[model samples]
Target chain A: MADAYESLTDHEDDARWAYGTGFSDPLAGVDTTVPSGIDHEDLAAYCLMLGDDALIMSHRLQQWVTRAPETEDELAIANIALDLLGQARLLLSRAAFVSGSGDEDSLAYLRPASQFRNVNLAARADADFAHLVARLLMFSSWRLALFDRLTGAADPVLSAIAAKGVKELTYHRDYAAQWVLRLGDGTEISRGRMRAAVGDLLGGSLVDELFAVHEVEERLAGVAVSPGGVKEEVLSVWGQVMRAATLAEGVGTTAPAGGRPPPGPPPPPPGGGGHDCAGGAFARAGSAFPRAGWA
Target chain B: MTSAAASTAATVAAGVADPEMPMLTLGDLGILRGVDEEPGRVIVTITPTYSGCPAMQTIRDDLTVALRAAGYREVEVRTVLTPAWTTDWITADGHDKLAAAGISPPGPAPRRAAGPVPLTLVPRASAISCPRCGSPETETITPFSATACRSLHRCTVCLEPFEHVKEI
Candidate 1:
């Protein structure tokens, strides 16, 4: 072993895994040209929708660092958050390229809550461990289903991003599913909490909007994978996981009270009534985890 | 430039070592896709081992600096995400280097079986052998590790902790 280790010590000082230390452009060689005929605005909006989802979801996951039930779980959640952050960077960069807007940082930190196009599920305040698991299960399942089809997108960058995401999201869904199963079947209190969290999320329409196809999505037809196209598949997978977890399948089946946003309306700017739909701000304040940079 | 000059440029770029796993070169890890010399400029294309790999920037800079020091006028490093990088891409030499460094190399990429969703489970202990003791008595310490591409493991025989390159 000593001899073998000695042979492998050729370049020991290089810290290859450090983040952003010697940073360079991730999209260095890739062509960012907007394909002919596709509306740049539509493409930009679509990328923002996806990017915001990942960014907000990453923030929510970051809340779990150092607070997870186990040390391993803490690392796992952080890893998942980092994965989403990577996806957000790529997608946001793509959005910036298409829209000719400011870069990813401008879109992520500069924009306010109301301007975000992510589904309300991701932006919700941190909840109990059960609620977090339930939300992750729903979000990862849906996103994975969507990404599976997106690997074939007409846009090469989108296709590449999706291809990378499909693998990460697969692990995310499975991780969440295992936790849901354990909690749902573990103890009386744990089971009840898991069930209630699932009900509140599904009943609240936090995930329904994800299935509602946007006009920008429709306009990009061939280039964008339709959310509606994957809804049935996502639902079916969710149903399976619920059954496996012994949780109720159709706890909340009501249509969301609001109608879908009309097509061609300029995307909503950051700031509005929809920002605090579920008392998310209050929950954030009440949580044990320190909320510093996130707010 | 002649074909011989281009080959030399490729060879120089391939020698740039991975920042994290210093034992392996970008070429050994199968990340160095190509190095082309055009007049006074050199373009190096590489694919990341994992989507969130932080070493990419360092690798890019290393390539630029190494080539510039070797008489190249301009060096451009490019990252390509398509044909997603996999552990299977790691060259045979990379496997030896990882093993020599007391880290277990990866097995085959996980098979994508026919299903609505692929099952992601913890890395199986049976598939990996201890790099330190060369013992098969190994167990997964955690599915998460210091980097996205690796997982923590313990060798029951050697009683030492090590990281295994995760199969994507």
Candidate 2:
């Protein structure tokens, strides 16, 4: 082994070490070509929406690092956060690549809160453990559904990223669901808190924004998975998890209005009219993409 | 440096052992992609097993020092993410090294077929043989372990708990 090491490392000139320092481009050899008919600017904006969501949520999860109830839980939450950070890194990089300006770090750190496009659910302040679990359950379910569809995307990079995300998000969703079950069925106080969390955090207008389609999503057509398309799948899975926990669907004090479109006609694409979210403000901006809704 | 010299440099870098799993070198783990020789610097490419692996910095530093000690003046390490690293890349020697170190090696990569399936309620344990007693009658203590690639398990025959390298 020492001989092998000597032979491999003895060169005076710059030679590749098995491992080296500095940043290596994760998408080094990936085919980053945007699909035909897909606008580069639209793709970049869409990536920001997805990447910002992960970046913000990862930060939230990081807040739990040393404060979790158990050492194992701390590690698990940290791992989940790291997973989201990884996804954010990739998506942000892709956005940079598409836009022809900025990089992952710039897009992530330099952007102001006003420029952020993540949903409101991800941006809220850290809540109690039950609230966090409830939020995670909903977020992971929705993201998993989106990623599952994104695996078939026309863009190879997006497809590859989604393929990897599916596994990680599966575990993430499972972790949150398990916690929901434990807390909801654990004790009277625990159950009450869990119930309040789901009703307060996930029940109202918060979820409605997740299903609203933006102009970027609509323009991408077959290239991007629309939030509205995955609404049923996301809701069904969430419903099953809640039912198993013995929590009533839509049991919050507030009416379950705003998040999802009513039984009638689909509201015009998010920027159409009377869309109260910040997304409308973004749409009014030079960019075709609408700003994402917040909590 | 000549092509032969570059290959030699890569071999040396590959020999550096992983800080977390010392028995297995980066080469054994298949993370050492290649070594490129430039005029004044050596660039090495590697892929991380997980995004937040704590050992990556250590491995990077170790590689730089190893090359410097071997007479190389400059070294640069690059980490990539695309074509994500998989457990299936562990070399045959790597598996043996893991087992000898009392860590059960991983099985094949998990199958990810298209379309949805029922959510997995119970955390599934891979059918891994115990490193201590080679016992098949083992049970998973937890789905997670100290590291992202491992899980806690105990051999039924030996009654000794051990770490199993989880299939990614």
**CA-lDDT, candidates in order:** 0.76, 0.74
The best candidate by lDDT is 1
Candidate with the greatest TM-score versus the true structure = 1
Tens digits of per-residue lDDT for model 1, A1-295: 4687554453543433353334445677887877788888888888888887888788778877767888878888888898998899899999988999788888877875456677776766544677788889889998998888888888889999998998888878888888888887677777766766676676654566778777788789888888888888888877777877777554444221222222121112123324433345423332322111111
TM per candidate comes to: 0.83, 0.76
Runs off by more than 4 Å, candidate 1: A1-23, A249-295, B113-115, B120-126, B156-159
- Off by more than 4 A, model 2: A1-37, A248-250, A253-295, B1-10, B32-45, B52-82, B125-130, B133-142, B154-161
Choose the strongest candidate by DockQ. 1
Q: Is the docking of candidate 2 incorrect, acceptable, medium or high quality?
A: incorrect
Q: Model 1 misses residue A73 by how many Å?
A: 1.5
In model 1 chain B, the worst 10-residue window by lDDT is B116-125
Give the lDDT of residue A76 in candidate 1.
82
Per-residue lDDT tens digits of candidate 2, residues B54-124? 56766777888888877678998876555767889899999999999899998988786756634654455
In candidate 1, chain A reaches a TM of 0.79
